[model samples]
Target: MTATPPHQHDVVIMGGGLAGLTLALQLKRRFADIDVVVLERRAHPVPHAAHKVGESSVEIGAHYFDTVLGLRPHMHGAQLRKFGFRFFFSEGRRDIDQVTEVGASRYLSVPSYQIDRGIFENYLGEEAARNGVRFVDSAMVRSLELAEDAHQPHRIEWSQEGKTHTVHARWLVDACGRAGMLKRKLGLAQANAHDCNAVWFRIGDRITIDDWSDDPAWRARCEPRARWLSTNHLVGAGYWVWLIPLASGSHSVGIVADPRLHPLDTMDTFDKAMQWFQTWQPRLYDELDGKRHLLQDFAFFRNFSYGCKQVFSGKRWALTGEAGLFLDPFYSPGSDFIAVGNTYITDLIAHDRAGHALEARAQLYDQIYHSFYESTLALYTDQYPLFGDPEVLPVKVIWDYTYYWGVLSQIFFQQRLTDMAVLGSLREELQDCQRLNFAVQDFLRAWSGVSRRRNRPVMLDQAALPWFAELNRSLNDRLDDEAFKARMRASAERLRALAMEILERARHDNPTLAAGELGTLLAEKPARLRSDAPSEAMLFEPG
Candidate 1:
């Protein structure tokens, strides 16, 4: 018998999860006739609410899904519109209504969703197939032979129905989530300083936080009474509990903790988690008490935050999603980064198709991607200790969201992620923002150490902050190069003003509080300085 030849495609994407499927759909959408194949290990229609962990979406991720991919109809129909992030400093307390609540009292201008992963990915697979993508579900990739040079095609061996098959492609992408077949084969795994663990599960019924309290005052705290729609966080000294609603009438719950404070062994299983919750979050325990039979799934990850040495390559191979790098899920940035990585990969593929040399482009994208990862890592690294301090965490959250919306979200919303000239022009402002963030994070930690961990009964409504709300609303504004550059400069100015306010407030409360690098970063720049600095009222006043 003669040996059979393998089928060939323009791009071969491994793993049929959210990342792989979305990449295929994006390539098809961009190139129209481009041949792409996605190999997925799991069968179609995985499950409903209990399938995956990443359920919440922020501004960037939400924009990517709702606008970039043109899935607004499906999202609006099948997913829950998020009511912004809600927080409660109700650790070890059953009275969640009395805790310091920090969140928007109403919806923001932009929207995000609480996704049902299984439903969404299944829909993505169907969409990919409709768009002429060769999606092979239940097909496990057995091995890969990545071409060393651009002229040759990379080869993939996969097994389905107990039969082996082979395929060839000009480009190869690994979106295999944590399996990271390509990452492992190429020795791309690395570690970071964030040492945290997580345990997550989905309950069969909705765990409505609004219904947990009946006080008219607490119920009326939010407009339209929709706190259940928000990605709610219950915070404590070293951990935060997430409550996200799913379209499937289930509620997703998770505990993310610094291993140093709350060890994994304390809540690795369902019984243990319930017991742990009873101790730390009695309100949640009460809600889940009789629903043990409704427990759908439970899973955990140790040291979840990781780094990849490389992702994009000149040799027509790349990695996206978890195969590349993951910072932290604190702000629901997983899908946001996926959208970003996939965009970069698609652009690289376009460059290759145009017969352009990819070495320089690939290296530049990798550098930019790594810069994003490192910058986001700063937000979570050594910051868990401050999660419980209601007084400080609200300030940190406000500042963090400002940085996200003011700088990075602008790049993505304005569709300038790949514009080298624009990025170069705004590099100094971006760097200034990053440095100011580093200093402020340090300052926050120090403030949390000395100040009173005030947990008041009032809501720190984000919408009340005029500039903050406008910064978010401005994400959809159209701007040319100069206007965009001006926006970046203004954003940097906003960050500087906010950093100064935080320093001044902290100093006023605790006169010994260190300003760290704010003295240099917040200093006036002759070329561009704002005369109208933000008022002290921008932040929540001390009661």
Candidate 2:
């Protein structure tokens, strides 16, 4: 090992990926005079080819970067600016399609953006440097030295340029994505043991966004098209393709499949993956149309899980981003989660610097953070069938209503408070929904009963209204029953109208909203949700 470096820092962050870099920037911003060092295994500004995956962001996540961290100005030059997500569920044009806007305003509430991951990370690195964080490239952290006292400072050993060095820090952060070097070294790493592995790459020239009309409202609001293609066709197994637009008119596309449905071993090399993509993703295959260039090489991973039980060990160590939790990317929450984690870490660091007792706060953060992932796991693992079922359509519709209300609530009411409370509430809701899980599962098993036999595509009708009304009544009790039903009717009408509006907006290429504009919608009370109602009360009941 090379000789130890002579200097020490207040914090040493491992891995220079999104989470690492964001925390580095946030820490320096909050504590300007503290010495912060970032160790990255790759050389400066890691060269990553543009890819189709890792393109979408959720509203809650975007708010942190744009408003909380104040990185919006820097992100203005990103390849794509997305208003919300547009989901399509089949290979050909005849599949189920839905669009959900993610922001706060009824007129201007689109929630997130899409961008090239490589470019975005590069921008973060530069921003971190500007904020006074020292980023050391080509240095891989091999192991950590726990302070002999176990409560004192810790030492980090890393290698670069064929030399080994040790550095001491009052605090350490692990932002290492996927590799989990620090996590493994600390013996905090654990397998998810549930999710399947996925492989992805980007194909350029074969894809284009011109076929997708720009929304004038979206254009005015600076919203870019972030398209995702899911599958209900082509053998009907679980797999998806995504086509996201970037700044330079380039597109990113990739496939995510269930290992049991589509094993990667069948496609061992980049060529095999491409061939599979051509066979499965017709639009992408047609777009490629003989193109020979690849923006990214093949990348794969096995079934992933979340939660690093010990994200922060005492006063001097913490984990952020993927190092802390690796939720399934079905929601496209990568950057958002990283940004949120960084914000929390910065808050803790600030508290420590102020000499307050932070152990309680740290523990609270871990639980809340764990709750977020746990809630996510529940949704993806247990509730995912809602997306593919018809008999459970009413439940899915109600859930969507709940989801939108929850998003609005967070932005308007919960923003000023701790996230733990919000997540804690959600955890309760998930537990309450556990009984409903079997109902949803049964619906999935008999999906063909309603879906396949239809002579014409069936859209949800007024029959779903009562269930939604009951749900609304159960969740909030301030409004009278009649008034609550009216509100549900209104919200449902609005959703239907919004669907048409989205189609028109897409056709005309218009952008309708801006960041931070959704506060208006939240100002109005949603359909009266009753505190004493079964669903609402069940959600808050003792677990």
Candidate 3:
């Protein structure tokens, strides 16, 4: 930035948290000789397992750690293998399983983890250093000087131990979480419609969901019955409470809500959060009442989901993780995006170092990346109002997961992320899913408006649902290109049929309900769905 700095590395990454550390390790692993430096603001040995909020991983992020990054050994030894997601729609009930619950009876075929952020980050830092990547701790980045010319290197200035330092690099990456250092410096911040708020705390010991109920039938629903290992959700109007177990025997509890309905000020403190829980989720509140003295930490954030104007650029700079864009944490996608964005950044640097033109690829990546972000955003934005609708919310969950596993997840698992021709061919299908998502979200809102909350006591076992279970197992299929496309096409048709089923159920429940956008989507005759595909029976089946 100032002509040139005295000392330089091939790449300089800011914010040595999860994203930065992972990227550093990835770069060194891919291009062994490439010089990389990671600057972290906090000193190491931050804490044990309860360091950060996001500890759970879904499929894509889990795959990034296990298959792509080759961290399977550590994953099995140090982290907890996640039981599939569980949701309890017991708004005011003390008996949890007696209420309408949706979850799997057995583990899914694929793998994910309940990560202890501190433990994972510590391991990543050590691995990065061991693999010849320079990891600097307690280092604060002051400024980023992105070169106007694509061919020029970027310059970064940082402060460490009361001393200022400057370094130049061919590539600069920002992985700072919410700080968004470079994002704010360049005025790249943009707002989304999902103005959600969150409050989370770590308990000193595990708050086992299983211990809350003593009904033998409820406990026997699972095969290897251990409900506490799952990322359990206690849902109500406009909010959901997450209870995740850490490897250190502590539990991570969070309450994320639509700010308008459940104000952040209402639950900003431990006591306040307890009161809110007691009002909405009495079962969870009763469970935590005895453990109040063992509370570890509490924090809150308003409007956590956001967008960035530009993440990747031909200007030799890129943004990753929370420094770029953040979708709602409803599904824990932060690490998945880190895996994806980090891969793209390293790929760009690799191309540049090999003397290849990367401008076109960067542009394409940006378009596709933002497209993915926007598509996922549709799942959470303005959808929180339906969180407590026991009938519609369950249906919404099925459809949301179908779209996720079928479209985006297939691309990731098939290792076809950068495959433009494939993405182009599936353009119509992806667009349909996005449009369908918007329509369904609207329909749920309308459905919730006219419908009543049937907080009935019953376990809606997800594993017993044939098509749902099939989709979960299908993730492991080793498909050729032909079969993959066929599968995707089948998935799209299934979604179409699923939409029809959802619309029909809503109409049956609310005779006076206006179909709105959902009616319009169903008006257009979809292509004939497969005979064996899911039907209305599959969607409306009893547990």
RMSD of each: 1.7, 10.7, 2.2
Q: What residue runs in model 3 are displaced by over 4 Å at the alpha carbon?
A: 1-5, 525-527
Across 85-166, the per-residue lDDT of candidate 3 in tens digits comes to 8899877778786788888888878888999998889999998999998888998888878887866778788888888888
lDDT of 1 at 191: 93
lDDT (Cα, tens digit) per residue for candidate 2, span 160-189:
887888888877888877777667777787
- What's the lDDT of the predicted structure labeled candidate 2? 0.53
Model 3, residue pairs in steric clash: 98-457
Ranking by lDDT: 1, 3, 2
Superposed Cα deviation of residue 275, candidate 2 (Å):
4.3
Better of 1 and 2 by TM-score: 1
lDDT of each: 0.90, 0.53, 0.85
The residue ranges of model 1 lying beyond 4 angstroms of the native Cα positions read 1-3, 524-536
Query: Candidate 1: RMSD over Cα atoms?
Result: 1.7
| TM-score top scorer | 1
Q: Which ranges in model 2 have alpha carbons more than 4 Å from their true place?
A: 1-5, 48-53, 92-108, 148-151, 209-236, 267-270, 274-279, 382-401, 404-413, 416-543
